[model samples]
Target: MASESPACNICESIISQTIQTDDRKEIQIARHTVNEHFDRLQRELLKELQIIENDKRKEISKILAPVERKEKEIDGLQISLAIIKQHASDLQTFLVSKQIEHELIDTDNLIQSIQNNSELSGVIVSLQTIGMMKSLGNISRFGQTSQSDMSLVRQKIKQAQAKVAVVTKGSLDHQHGTIKTEEGL
Candidate 1:
């Protein structure tokens, strides 16, 4: 019995070491899985954000095209008016002046229409990440590790049965004492 004590302690130490080694491997695998998932998620998010930025930029460019054309038209009209004033007769100047006035009014109306439509005013691009942010904030850990008591119980029962068998054999061979089972019978 005294010699069995060291053997039991050695068995327990081996079991503990094996469990710790298995736990370390499982933990490393979990860490790698978590990192891979996050890396994939980050790539997907950045791709989505880049696509949104490009789309918004295209929309803004579309909105600015007509305004830019109108600005050039206005500049051309002003240059033409200055040229006509310096180089044309009164009658020609008057006729061109009337045409220039109508063009200016049309340009003003177009600008007003653009303003009323709110095309430029309402061009807003924003990321809606409140839910994602909240979810991230709520995450306490990547994963959980748990030990089941059923396996431990089964192992202890097997160990106890083996000890009982050894004691039974010793008693039968040496006839030293009676074997005491768990029931104390």
Candidate 2:
């Protein structure tokens, strides 16, 4: 009976050792499977994160579209404004120059007319007989008339010159104002 008990104890020990070894092998298989599945899950997560990043980039671009369009519009408007300002400056210059040229021509014509009138008056006075002068008009009246005509012509020339100066100054002031506006912009 004692020998049979020893043999049964030995058999129990052997079964325990075999069970532990099987348990260890099962644990290792489970660990290997978990590790492989974890790798696949990590790859899937990385792919999804990349997709999300691409989507976010697309959304950001979509949000900025209107801003980009508005920036282009503002640039176009600025260019148009510059062109308009340049054209206005050109027109103002043309008008001012033309006005000055016309005024100068008018002044020259007035002076020529005055010289012609003075010459005609002198010839008339020199050729006039005393009786004819008396019959027509007094010599003082002729002198006064010629003097008044010459004085009126001189006044007109002076007035035209002053007007030209005023016009030029006004244009210059407008040009300066335009420059200031551009600088501020």
Candidate 3:
């Protein structure tokens, strides 16, 4: 019985050690999985943000192109008008002046139209993270660890006891001449 106690203790210890080792392995695997998931999520989020920014930039550029073209045309017209006024005769100046006035009115009307259409309106960019933020905030811990059951250890102890009982019975039978070796000793 005293020897049996030691055997049971050894069996329980081995079982506990095995359980601890498995638990550590499981923890490591879980940590790796979580880290990979967050890493992928971060990459995806950054990609989406970049795409949005690029789209917004394109939209703003589209809005500004016509205005910029009109501004350059007006500058060129002013320079041409000045040259004509300084270098032309009265008849030529009168004709050129009429053409310049029409050009100026058209340019002014285009500018007014752009203003009225709100082409230069402000663009606002923002992230919609309320749900994500709430979900993140709700998380208190990455995971939880739990105690393993002792039923496996108990089962192992029982098997060890059965083997010990068989060995003891075999020895007792041999000593009482109820069991014999193949060759007489």
Q: Best-fitting candidate, measured by TM-score?
A: 3
lDDT of 3 by residue, 104-162 (tens): 78777877886799875676767788998999899987767777667776766777788
Candidate achieving higher lDDT, 1 or 2? 1
Against the hidden true structure, what lDDT does model 1 obtain?
0.77
- Whole-model lDDT for model 2 versus the true structure? 0.61
lDDT of 1 by residue, 55-159 (tens): 878977887788788788878877887899899998878887888788788878877987898866755556688998899899987766777465575567567
Candidate 3: worst 10 consecutive residues by lDDT? 176-185
Clashing pairs in 1: none
lDDT of 1 at 81: 79
Query: Weakest 10 consecutive residues, lDDT, candidate 2?
Result: 139-148
Clashes of 1: 0
Q: Listing every candidate in turn, what is its Cα RMSD in Å to the true structure after a full C-alpha superposition?
A: 8.1, 63.1, 4.4
